[model samples]
Target: MVLKTAIFFVISIAAFAVMFTTMAPLTGFLSYHDVPRIVKDNNEETNWFALTESLLWDIFLVLLFIVQHSMMATPTWRGLIYNLGLVVVERSFYIAATAWALQYIMQSWLVIPDYPLWIIDTSQSTPWWWFFTLIHVMAWIIIYGATFTMDLPELLGLKQCLYRDTAWEFALICTICLTARFTNKGIQ
Candidate 1:
C-alpha cells in the first residue's frame, strides 16, 4: 500500500506539473507581451501584484498537497476537496485584494486622464471576461464540493480505493470545462 501510494503521488505531481507548465507557456505564447502590457496599461500595478500573489499561493498549495499526500497519505476525496477549498479561498483573497488595490491606484494615479471612474466599473456588470472568470472560479467550487461529497460515502464504506484512475479522468473533464469557460470558448 505504501509503495503504491508513493508511486501514485509521484506520478500525480509529475503529471500536473508538466501539464500546467506546458499549458501556461503555450497560452502565454499567443499573447505574451500583450497580456502584461494590458495589465500595466488597463490595470494598476497592484492588479499585477495580485496575479503574482495568486500564483505564489498556488505554488505553495501544490507543495502543501505533495507533502501532505506523501507524508499523511490523505487519499480520500474529501481530503482532496478540502485542499482545493483552501486553494479557492486563497485565490479569492488574491482577487479581492487586487481589485481593491486597483481601485485605490486608479483613484490616486489618475492614469487615464479622460476615462472617469464611472466609465470603468469593476462590479458584476464589468465585462464578459470578468464574468467568465467568476464563472470558472465558481465551477471549481462545485466540482470540488461534489467530488468531496461523493467520496465521503466511499471512504466510509471502504468500498473502493479512494482515487482510482477514473477519478483522474473525471478531473480531466472538469479541468477541460474550467479552461473552456475561462477562455469564453465552447468545449470542442
Candidate 2:
C-alpha cells in the first residue's frame, strides 16, 4: 500500500510539472523556451516541402491532442487500465499525456499569415492593453479559484485510494462566481 501510494504521488507530481510548463506557451504568454511572445508571422520563413507541410503538422498535432484527450477520458480506457492493475496512476497518465500533447502543439504550432480582424497596439494604447490584460488575468484567477474550491484530489482521482468528501457549499459559491465571471466576460 505504501509503495503504491508513493508511486502515485510521484506520478502526480510529474504530471503537474508538465502541465505547469505547458501553460505559459498554451496561454500565449511565452512562445517556446525564452521567446517572450508569439507573433502571427513567427513561422513565415520556416517551411519544409511546402507551406502546406507546416499546416499539415499543425493539423496533426491538433488531431493528436484531441485523440489523446478524448480516448483517455472514456470509461472503457479506465476499465482497461484497471484490468491491467494500473488504475492507481490512471489520472496521472491522462494528465501527463495531455501535457505532452499540449507541449507538442505549442512547440510545433505554425503561425498563420497575418490576417488580423482587429489589432491593438500595446505600445500606443498602454492603458487599454493593461486593462484587457488585467481582465484576462482575473478571468483565469476565477477559474482556478473555482477549481480549488472543489475536491481537487477527487477530481484528479487521488481520492479514490484516499477518500475525502467535497464541501458542497463552497463548491456552489465557486460555481456562482465562475458563472458570473464568464457572463461578465461575454458581455465585454
Candidate 3:
C-alpha cells in the first residue's frame, strides 16, 4: 500500500509537471528555451525538411496519444490491466504516457516560416488587448479552480488509495464556492 501510494504520488506530480509545462505558454508564465510556443512569429528561417518531417512526426505523435488515451479508457483495456495486476497504477500510467506523448509533440513542433496564422502584437500596448488578456488568464484560472469541485483523486486515479468517502462532501462545498466565485467575477 505504501509503495502504491508513493508511486501514485510521484506519477501524479510528474503528470502535473507535464501539464503545466504544456499550459504555461498559454498563461504567459513559461518561457522554456526548448519548448516551442503554440503561437509564434512565422518569419524565422527554418530548414525545409524540418517543417515537413516535424509536421509528420507531430501527426504520428497525436495518433499515438489518441490510441493510448482511448484504448486505456475502454473496458477491455481496463480488464487487461486488472488481469495484469496493474489496476492501482492504471490511471497514473495513462497520465504519464499521455504526458510523454504531449511533451514529444511540444518538443518536436515545427515553426513554419512565412505562415502567420493569428499574431497579436503585444507591443502595441492596446487597452483592449490587455483587457482580453486578463479575461483569458482569468478564464483559465477559473477552469482550473472548478476542478477542485470534482472528485480529483478519482479523476487522478488515487481515490481508492488516498481519498475517503467524506471527500465528496468537501467536493460539493467546493463546487458551491466555485459557483459563487464565478458569479461574483461575472458580476464585476
Candidate 4:
C-alpha cells in the first residue's frame, strides 16, 4: 500500500510537470513545439488533400483526449477502479492519464495551414508587445491563484496518499480538480 501510494505520488507529480511544460505553449507557450513550419504569412501554397488530412488528424487528437478525459470521470469508471481496489491511486492515475493525453495532443497536434484570419501588427518597438505579455502573465497568475484556492495537493493525490482521510474527504477528492474545469466551482 505504501509503495503503491509512493509510486503514484511520484507519477502524479511528473504528470503535473509535463502538463505545465506542454500546456504553457499550446494553451499558454504558443508555437514552440517542433513543427517544420509555423504560422506563415499566408498559406496560398497549401495542398487541399494534405490540409484536409492534417485537419482531420488534429480533430482526432482533440476528440481522443476528450474521450479519455470524460470516460475517467464517469461513475462507472470510478466503480471499476473501486472494485479493483485501486482507489488509493485513482487520482494519481487519472492525473497521469490526463497528462499523457495532453502530452500526446501537444506533440501530435498539426499546425494547420495558416489563414491569418486577423493579423495584429504590433511592431517590435511598440509597447503593445509588452502590454500583451503583461496580460498573458496576469492571466496565468490568476489561473495559478485560483488553483491554490482548492486543495491542489489533495487533488493531485499527495495528501490523500500521505495521510489517511475519512470517507467524506476521499469522495470529494475523487471529483475532478476544479479551476476552469468546474462550472460552479471555477471563476463562475
Alpha carbon lDDT of residue 69, candidate 2?
A: 95
What TM-score fits each model?
0.22, 0.66, 0.60, 0.70
Better of 1 and 4 by TM-score: 4
The alpha-carbon lDDT assigned to residue 152 of candidate 1 equals: 42
Query: What digit string (tens of lDDT, one per residue) describes model 2 on residues 6-33?
Result: 7767777677677767766676633122
lDDT of 2 at 60: 90
Report the number of clashing residue pairs per model.
0, 0, 0, 4
Task: Give lDDT for model 3.
Answer: 0.64
Residue pair clashes in candidate 4:
24-28, 24-29, 25-29, 25-30
Name the lDDT value of residue 77 in candidate 4. 95
> Which prediction has more favorable TM-score, 2 or 4?
4
Prediction RMSDs, each to the true structure: 17.4, 10.1, 10.1, 7.0
The lDDT of each candidate is 0.42, 0.68, 0.64, 0.69
Kindly give the stretch of ten consecutive residues in candidate 4 with the minimal lDDT sum.
Answer: 28-37
TM-score (C-alpha, index-matched) for candidate 1: 0.22
Top-TM-score structure, candidate number: 4
Q: What TM-score does prediction 4 earn? A: 0.70
Regions of model 2 farther than 4 Å from truth: 29-53, 161-188
**Considering lDDT, where higher is better, how would the candidates rank from best to worst?**
4, 2, 3, 1
**What tens-digit string does per-residue lDDT give for candidate 1 at 1-188?**
55654554454444334433443343333222212112236444445555556557646645554554444333453466457643212222222333333333323331222322233333435575576556655765685467576744232222122344347457658888789787855655
Model 3 pairs whose backbones collide: none
